[model samples]
Target chain A: MMKILVVDDEPDVRTLFEQRFRREIRSGALAFSFAYSGEEALGYLHEHHSEVVLILSDINMPGMSGLELLRRVRTEPAPPPPPRVMMITAYGDETSRTQALALGADDFLTKPVDFAALKEKLLALPSA
Target chain B: MSALYNFDLLVAGPLCMLIVLALRRFFNLAERLPRWNQALSWVWVPAVLGFGITAAFRYRSTLLDDAYMLWVYAVVVLTLLLLWNYRPARLALLALAPLLLHRLVRFGLDLGNLRLLAPYASLFKGWGNFANLWLIGLVLVARSQKRLLAKEQQQRQQEEQAHQLIATQNAELERLVAERSATLTQQAASLQQALEELQLTQNQLIQAEKMASLGELTAGIAHEIQNPLNFVNNFAEVSAELLEELAEEQAKPSPDTELELELLGDLTQNLQKITQHGQRAASIVRGMLEHSRASTGERSLTDLNALCDEYLRLAYHGLRAKDKAFNATLHTDLAPVLPLVEAVSQDLGRVLLNLLTNAFYAVRQRQQQGGEPGYAPTVQVRTRRVGDEVEVQVQDNGTGIAEAVRQKIFQPFFTTKPTGEGTGLGLSLAHDIIVQGHGGDLTVASQEGRGTTFTVRLPIYSPE
Candidate 1:
């Protein structure tokens, strides 16, 4: 099963993600780990870097931003072929999009995220 | 005249020469003498002495035997000696003293009647008389020379005084001119400084106004949009799960296909609309937040009429957030052909927001008071491009300010709203941004108990 980590400051995002991917989750095709902030996401990665196939994070958060999380994930000295990182932002801001791409983000999405497009992108990953 | 020329006359010439030399040395004549008079006495002194001396030797014996000869010699010698004792007028008196002595001596000689002395006495008397006339002429000439010298000295002094006066006046005039020029330059520099200071203050006021409007909008936006966002988010999540369940039901044995498909289509459409409207609300909240952030102060070309229209709706909605029951009709007369202008949009938007808030407040106040029949609370915003400038006006037909209060409206810390409800910095800050920051004009026109209108004129291009 593909394991994905979702990080956001809003607690409702956890519920939204679970609902959107309910079929895949029930079929044993995918699993999701949740973190409310960049710091919490990093703690999860430290213990489960091998299990996590991708990280989906929101850009504007209370503590570390999604861009900073992307940087840390890209530079992590983990096992071969680190997980992919996708940055999500609230306002479709061009400056943040460019910055995230430069910081080694795999893709960018804006809120409210299109789950259909996100699922297609996720299925294309090698781990899936 | 021949009889008068004798030994005594010859001696008189030498004696007169002595008197002239003595007068010249004692009176310092050469220094005082005018050019014409200097040479006047040079030739005449030698000629008089030469003629008298030659004739005196010829008649020497006759003149010496008479008693009057002694008198003639004595008078000439006495006049020379006395010349040192008196000034010009007194010297003339001394010349006459000798003539009086001669007359008294002649009277005695006639009374004696010595016939031998008679003929020689007439010759001596004539010589003495001629000497007296010569002495008198010298005194008159010397006195006239003194008068001419005195007049020349007076004229030189007058010229010196006139030159000194002119120099002093010239110095005074130059000093006055320099002082006036310096004052004008100083005043011009100070005026320039004052203008720059005024501009700086205006920019600050606009910045403060932005902060104030943002402070109010943040609370209202948070409360107003949070519920709608929850609805959108909650419904979308439920619909996504339901769609998954529908897919599971389809995979199961024979389903009521057309009815189920229709119900699913309706659910999908409803969720899509809810999600779309939620995102739109989020974007608006983001825009309101942008207004309060630090601006780059750089200008961009923006559509003025569109910006005004957007702000009008945002302000009305913001007020709705605070007062749930507050509602008013909003009217817009936006110009269709407004050219895009280079301006700092965030600052301009704040100015518009402040004016709109005040307008809404005015109408609300009138509504609360509940007087005036058939009064509808209304706010109108209009925009147009006039020449090189864009004009925006916000008007409210409720609770118009008194004439005296209108004058004080744009002053900082001035407000009609009650304490604890206002900072009184809104209108002043708006005034600063329009007038100082954008090189614009902000003005108000109102009649008490009728209505109020705030007009802002902003230049389209900001010169670097």
Candidate 2:
């Protein structure tokens, strides 16, 4: 199963992600972990870095920004391969997109994310 | 006998002419002397010549004696005329009067035929000569007196002219002083008007700054509204999908009852989320509208805790929108039971927002400086009910204000922010709203490099 970690300040993101991926989870094709902030996501990665194949994070949060998280995740020592990171932001401006890309973010998404498009992107990824 | 007559004619005629010349020259009476009076003075000359001729021929004619008596009458009339016309010649006229009197007395004696008084006639002749000498001395004295009188008149005229000149100068000086005073009064009036205009311009600038701050909040408000909108749309769309799935399960000839229940339950949850998020968006819009609306200056009961929370979040989000990387830990220690405060909500909200913004700004600035290792910027907002007063405190662990700057912080146009970033009216207007508008107090405590705290205290019951 593909394990995906979702990081967002809003608690409702967990419910939405879980509901959207119910079919994949029941079929034993996908599993998900949720974190409420950049700091929490980093803590989760420290313990289960090998299990998390991908991380999707909201850019604007209280403590640390998604771009900073992406930079730390890219630089910090981890197992053989680092988890791919995708940034989500309500602003979705060109500056943030370029900065996120420069900081080694694998993908960028805007708010009110299209689940179908996200599903297709997730399906296209190489399965573990 | 002829020698005495000739000697008398020479002495008397010359004496009368000399008296006339002295009156004309010394008293300046010639211009005023009448033609008849001048002719009378020349009559003496003819009389003297006639008497000399008669005596030379030894002619004892009565006509010559009568002519001598008429000459004496002419001398008396001329002296009277001089006295009447010129007041200064009165002394000279008095001397001439004695001589004329002496002549009249001698003629009277001769007319009366007093041969027994012939010795006395010699005595009368001696008296007449003394009278002539006395007239000469008096005339000389009169001329000197007239000279002194003319000098006194000239000195009086000079003094009067000088007095007139002084009066003219004094009037001119008074007029000049009045004119200068009028100009000064006009200048002062214009200065007062200019000061009023400046005050009006300052008020306009303050209003503009208020609108500008609202404009700055628009971005944060947009972000806030957008977040809930995203949630609403997503939930609605997900709910639709769940409804379709439930419809499909119901359409099956033999659908699984448990699966149908699960789909129905998810649909219910999605619908609830959609409603929740829609309400969230609505509340944010309402708050923004209230903030941007023009103040009506109306008072209402307000919940201080809720007001503080709302403003603190708005300020944080607003700063985050401007600087995406900025972040701070916000702690709220609001009283559980706070009495409603009677206040103009809009004005009070503005004051709270300004204080929170400043606290965030201070923390952000310290964060950027990166002065201390392992330093975490924190801002704490606390509200408490202290007896009859409600206190709201905004504290930040950031760069503290200096003592010199703190003293003038509430004065208008005093700012530490860079130009174009701040209008400098925020704190001053906040102070005014708290102290003047609401009859409250705003106080600040700070230590350099430590932190800053701004406290706002409002009476539970307004004194107004």
Candidate 3:
């Protein structure tokens, strides 16, 4: 089972991402979770570290940031570290991309989210 | 008859010399005189004495003596008249003093009335008379010579002055000629410079206008291609799935079916690729079109925040589509209460698109230089209400521009990209649309290696 965590400050964007992948969730091909802020996502990571396989985070959020989270996740001493993290942003700027990629983000996705392309990307992920 | 009055002659030099004297003080008629006049008799007095000698010469004959004295006195009177032209006539008649003296002395020499003295005056028949006559002649000659010398001196002075005047005028003429030549040369150079600048500006405006029209065409074509490409993508994906279903249903061993499945798979794969590439092409076209297109004459109260988001997404997607490994951290500090800018939606949209696209390219350039592979490039688009203006700032923490190029970045067709990639029209068109077309302000602030910030100041009510 693969778990995908979605984080964003905007509830609508988080909802949209969830709604797009909801069908796969019901069919049991993927399990999805959500966090409104970086802190919440980090808290979820603490509790459900093993269940999480892929993380999708937004760059601009109050209380910690997506880049900070990516940096932290990369530095964790655990073997194999955390799951693959992808940044989803409505604001896709060059600086954000480089910083996120450097902090060990596996991929970067910009909005308005191209769900069809995104679905293919999620499906191509290696099964753990 | 060469018969002339000696006093008349002698007085001519003195009288004329007085004119030079009054005009420019030829003699010490002024308060000062040089060595010749000093330690010498009054120059005029010696001439007066000499004139009296001619009267003495006439004393050789009684008839001549009387005539000489009478005529010499008259000549003296006329000379005095000319000299006294500026002074009083009463003073000039003082020459009659000599006449009175001659009369007194003549009567004293011989006891005679006016008629007897007239014929046998004291001018004849004795050495005493001759010596006196000789003395008088010497006096007349000396005075005449002095008068000629005074006249000569005055002529020399007039000639010197005329020469000085001519030299001054010649120098002035030369100076005027040189100055006029310099002025003409400067005017020609200025005219040439103005002409060159005008030509450059004309080329830029033409390029911008053409780019504007090209942008519209590219956008329309991209939109036009979009619908068909979307259909192809949708139908191809649907077909790929349908074929899988068929392959599952017919579990019989058929070589022809296997071949059929293989061919369809290839077709599906190719179509998928075509869709991907077509979408990318369309996006690029749209980006170019958005940048190049001018705003429709539609004015609306615009939300700068939303505009930034749209263009930021376009730029990011376009960049990402090119390099998949590029992942940048994005931040937006959009003021919720940012005053609405009365804007031409399309024009402002292009300006934002140009800035965002440049920001992405700048960062990509840094990455290409092998600075850092995964250092997430950061771009922040912020909006603020400053004074009466709504300022939209697009900031990117990428490779900052060098100081030298910062000034020329906004010039049309000035691009830092490799050949065939950049037209360098992005900032220039943005400047025209913002400052010229829209009556707004566009400014840039950058630090090398830190980042660059492009600020757009839009008035709350965009003026027509």
Candidate 4:
């Protein structure tokens, strides 16, 4: 199964992602793990470096931000075959998109996230 | 010659008394010439007595001549004494010198040749009459001189009185001018004080206008955030519906009990999140309503952390609502165990709003300048309890304020923003609200091209 890590400050994001990807999970095509902050997401990545193949992160959060988290995930020492990181923000501004792309974000999305389009993009990605 | 002598003896005593009385009455010499008055007093008494003696002893010519000569000698001696004592009348009294000389001559002739003098007795009598007429002329000259002296004395007194009046009037005029100038000075001071008060009132009015606009911006932000919150609610509801459908499928025969349990659990969690987000939206609406409401200037114990957090969100969203392209990383470090502070929450909220708005503006401006690459526009808000004070700090990693601008930042009507973009009373009003209204302190520290930090220190207890 393809493993994905979802990071957001809101605890409710876990439930939303679980419901949105319920069909794929039941079919044994995907598995999801959740972290509520950039720091927690980094910890998860360290523990399961090879298991997590994709990371979905919200850009705005207290403490460490998503952009910082992305920079660290890309630059910091880790196992070979790093996970693709996608950035999500409430403000869909060109500056944030450019900054995210410059910081090596694989994709950018605005909220209320287009889950259907997000699902199509995920399906199109080469499976692990 | 005898008849002429008799007429002279009868009239001379009375006429002398009459002349002295006229001088005293007409010239007011009794008051003007005191020594003359004293001498005249002695003369009038002797003349009257001499007249009495002459009238009583007219039959005895020898006795009559003795009385007349005694009186003449007394008059001459007193007149000479008056001329010595009273200098002003010396010239007038000198006219009587001839009378004294004539008396002495007659007396010498009587003593030398009484029978030989009988052949020229008429001539002698004529000379004696001329001497009497000269005495009369002397009296007229003395009267005229006395009148002139009296007029001169009156003119001198009048001039002196006029000078005194002028001096008094000048003193009164000077006093009036001094009094008027003092009043005018007092009025000018009061007017200056009034003008200062007017300027203060005008600054307060501009602050109120800024607050009103902030309230409107707050309402707009509430509406903007509300849209996304509504979407969240709708999406959560839809997810719950999908979960029900999954649960319905599991309810059929031979359903996977484990999957059914998980679907129900996710449905319950989704519904709970919907409720949580709805409450958050409700609180934001309430905060906006409170901001727009008229302030009652009431004080209460308020949670500083909550106030700061709410204003931070409002300011960020407000800016975002205006400029959708703006974005900044916000960091908050609120002390976990902070005490409630006694404060006017509405006024304090305005102060926080203003500070946050300024921080956001600074970051946005720096972002637009686009000089430094990899510059993440960042704003940090921190609250701490420092002994008796609660300190709030708003820091921005953006273009720092210049040293010159920082000095006058809190002054009213001092603006750095272009016209129509800022009212320039924001910092001034914030300073006033914190320092004057709540008896707190507001201070700033900045470095050009680096960053800026604004610190607000509020007392825990309200000042009485």
Candidate 5:
């Protein structure tokens, strides 16, 4: 099973993702772990560094932004083929996209993310 | 008396004295005469006395007969010469008074000898010579007094003329000073006006820069809000679908079917509400996205009237969200069958948003100021197609612009709103989007305390 970590400040986002990918979860193909903030996401990574294959994080948050989290995750020593980071932001400007990419983000997504497209992108990822 | 002495001394003595007096008085030769009148008088006194003695001897050789009369005539002439510069007439009169008193006394002492003394005076021409001398002295005194008066009058007139000239020059100088002062004041006022205009232009440029950055920020906020809204809507939809699947399962003649259906029914109702509200939120975010989108300066055919109507409602609702107490009636008179205008729809929508927003703000401001009874705060939007142009007008029956600031209302960053409430760049940017970018015209008409109307005319075919 692929373990994915979702980080966001809004609590509803966690429930939303779970409901959205419920079928995959029940089929034992996908497992979702949620962290309410960047720090909490980092803490989760510390305990299950090898198990988490992907991290989907929102850029705008109270403590430790998504970019900062991406930086830390990219540098962290982990098992072979480290977890991929996708930075999600409300702003869809070129500057933010460039900065997020420069900071080692594997993908950048804007708000009201197209889940259908995101699902295809995730499904195409190599087996964890 | 001897004939030679009588003829020579008697005539010659008087002739010499008369000649000297004539040179001093007439012929304008007084300047040539010597200033030694006293010395001249002494010379004449001795010559007249010697001539009188000779005449006395000629008149009576034996015993000095008529000698007393001769002495009297000599003494009188000497007295006249001594008083030359002093107006001799006055001196002669003063001497005559004393001489008359003496004569009266002598007449009292020798009244019988009066006849004999009188005959000797006849030889000297006594009273007649005195009268002639007195008359000449009076004329000289009158002429001298007249000359003094004439000189004084001439001096006084010259002083008066100089005073008059100075007064005229003083008046002219004051007028010039006043005129120059007025001109200087006008120049200063114009300079101050120019300075104020420059400051306003600087403020507008700063505001324009701020608006550009704000547009970028809005794009960011739109994307951010859209994500959550999408998630919310998608989750609700999925939950609804899950609930339907569970409902179909419960209807499959399963045990406890009645209880299960009731529970599922309640869940479905809750999920429906969520879906409805989430869609509503999504629409709002989309509207904001349209407003904040970057200008691409592309033209497209658009239904301008419908566009105006839609933005009018959005701006009114937006204001209501920000201010709960704000309320106003919006009236729209969009023309049916309006020709589509070739322009950037997104930029045009922003222009409508700005105009309608300003209109709503105006009416709301009037409502706050406690308007007249039955005064309904209203914003009226109208659209029309005339010739090859489409027109959009936004009017407010609120606090109209004052006459003084009417010309400046379209200027960038020239807002009347209080600081922090407005950036004063809305109209300026809207003008740029419509007129500069779209090849259109934006104009305004207003009456202070009555109402204001902003009209935007866009060409059907933009002359790119």
Candidate 6:
């Protein structure tokens, strides 16, 4: 089962994400973890480093935004290199996208989340 | 010592009066002049008249009683009259008093003695007491005219200087105005350039968002269409196998015709399922096409309740297809009797989809945050008639928005969602449609820990 870590400031947004993936979790197709802030997401990563295959993050947040988190994650000399990060934004601009892409984010998604495409992304995820 | 005079009462009195008047005009004009030129002329008038009397005394008439004295008096009075409007006239009049006294005494002492052999003794006697006083008045008039002339010259110079100063100030004011206009023009050009750059940036952002949404949609749309495609693929395989089986059975010989008829009927039923799948694929493609150009569409008398119900299910289904465990229980309190409004049906559906999905996400967020300890996640959608407008309210009892973020929550490119999860255009677009397009309003009221409610109002049948 692939473990996906989702980080955002909004709790309902994260919970709805879990509900979307509940069937996959029940069927043993994917595993899930959630964090409210970038700092918490990092803490989750420190413990569950081996299991996590992908990271989804929100860019605008209090105390260490998603871009900062992405940069920090990239800088660290850790095992299994780094999980493929996909930025999930409710608001997007060229500057944010350029910065995230430069920091090694694998993809970008705008909200009003399209689950079907996300499923394809999950299915297309490298050999985890 | 052979001088003789008889003072004529009329002439002497008039002569004194004229001198008094002359002195008065001189004094008045003295202060008013810049340098007193006209005042000096007053003194000359009296002196010239006195010389005429001296001439008369040397000729046939006496200096005292002759018309020459009267002529002298007349000249003095005329000078005074000429300068009557000047300021120094009072002092000149005071000087004329002593002259008047001398004239009075001479006239009284020598009256009726109209002889040329008038004694010089009387002349000297008559002049002695009043000569100094009368001469002082003469000197004042002279000095006054000099002073008056000088003042006029000084004032003329000052006027010329003032006029020059005013012209210089006008020039400076004009220069300042030109500089300000140029500065404003430069500022306007800079502002225009900035506006153009911003417009280009906005257009690019819109295009990028479209591409992103399209990418997101393709996966879900592919997944949705895949079911039908698979069904078509499977049916063709089954039919091909059936055709092979029938060929072998027919080659053996047709002993039981009823069995063949039953097989034929089953074949016809499979074709219907194939046709159904084809129809479903087309409908999804149509939904996607409708979503492509959201700004351009026709208005219709839309059933708001029905549109909301349908889009709400579609949005939920879209989310559920990706993660089945993302179980958000949706509760609806739709008004049974709702008003139909003139609006773009598809656009209204899009707005409903956006609001419902946001509510779903809000509820899901609460569950993730340990928001309510251990509780079931729920999203509530309610519609009602609020005044003349119909209100569609979507509420979620989730970890609600903070006060700080709530004010700008609906602004374009403002979102709490993860970078890829939202375009932030959803709420802003919804707001524009509800307010500008539909002549209504969209608003939200929320508490941090409790939940949030988004209310949308729609005008009923009122196109204007």
Give me the candidate number with maximum TM-score. Answer: 2
Q: Evaluate all candidate structures by whole-model CA lDDT and list the values in order.
A: 0.71, 0.81, 0.65, 0.77, 0.68, 0.68
Badly placed stretches (over 4 Å) of model 4 are A1-11, A28-128, B1-206, B212-220, B239-243, B246-260, B292-295, B321-326, B364-370, B401-407, B461-464
Minimum summed lDDT over a 10-residue window in model 4 chain B is located at B1-10
Query: Where is model 5 more than 4 Å wrong at Cα?
Result: A60-62, A89-110, A123-128, B1-135, B191-217, B243-247, B255-464
Computed on C-alpha atoms, the DockQ of candidate 5 is 0.10
Task: In candidate 1, list every pair of residues with a backbone clash.
Answer: B6-B56, B7-B56
User: What clash count goes with each model?
Assistant: 2, 0, 26, 0, 5, 69
Compose the digit string of candidate 3's lDDT tens values, residues B281-308.
Answer: 5655564555455445677887888777
* Residue-by-residue lDDT tens digits, candidate 2, B1-464: 65445455555566667755754566554555566456656746766787778677775554355446557556655555656655556776677777778766666656775543678867787888999898889877877787777788788888888888888988998999999999999999999999999999997888787777776667777877787788888877777777787888889999989988998888889888888888877877776777777777888898989888877777888988788778777789999999899998888888888888888889888889985878777889999999899999999998999999999999988899999888889999999999998899999999988899999999997557
True contacts kept of 5: 0.23
For model 6, residues B117-189, the per-residue Cα lDDT tens digits are 3686666556755666576865677576658765875888788788888888888888999999999999999
> In candidate 4, how many clashes are counted?
0
Q: Model 1, stretches more than 4 Å misplaced?
A: A1-128, B1-143, B206-216, B220-228, B256-267, B282-309, B317-355, B367-397, B401-447, B450-464
Model 6 deviation from the true structure expressed as Cα RMSD, one decimal place: 15.2
Highest lDDT: which candidate? 2
Cα lDDT tens digits for candidate 6, A7-46: 8765545434554554576688887788988889998888
Q: Native contacts retained per candidate? A: 0.09, 0.41, 0.00, 0.05, 0.23, 0.00
lDDT of 3 by residue, A1-128 (tens): 68888887555344344435545765788887888877788888888856789999877543366877787777866445468899965444677788787778889887545668989998888872
In Å, residue B385's CA in model 5 sits off its true spot by: 58
Q: lDDT (0-100) at residue B414 of candidate 2?
A: 86
iRMSD for every model: 14.4, 1.7, 9.4, 4.5, 14.1, 15.3
Q: What is the TM-score of chain A alone in each candidate?
A: 0.94, 0.95, 0.89, 0.95, 0.93, 0.92
- lDDT, residue A20, model 6: 51
Q: Give the CAPRI rating of model 1.
A: incorrect
CAPRI accuracy category, model 3 = incorrect
Q: Candidate 1 DockQ score?
A: 0.05
Local error of candidate 4 at residue B278 (angstroms): 2.0
**Chain B alone, TM-score, model 5:** 0.43
lDDT per residue as tens, model 1, B1-464: 65655545445445545655665664555654444225424423443454456465654334232334344334434443544443553555565556656654665555564443677767767857775785668567767755664566577777778877888888888898889989989999999999999889767765665666776676456543653575586666668667766787788798768746854874766577577658757766766766877776778897878678767767775775565446576778999888787878887887888898888888878878886766667899888888888888999987888988988998987988887567678878778778888889999998777788999998877568
Judged by DockQ, which candidate is best? 2
Candidate 1, chain B, TM-score (2 decimals): 0.51
Assess candidate 5 and give its TM-score to the true structure: 0.44
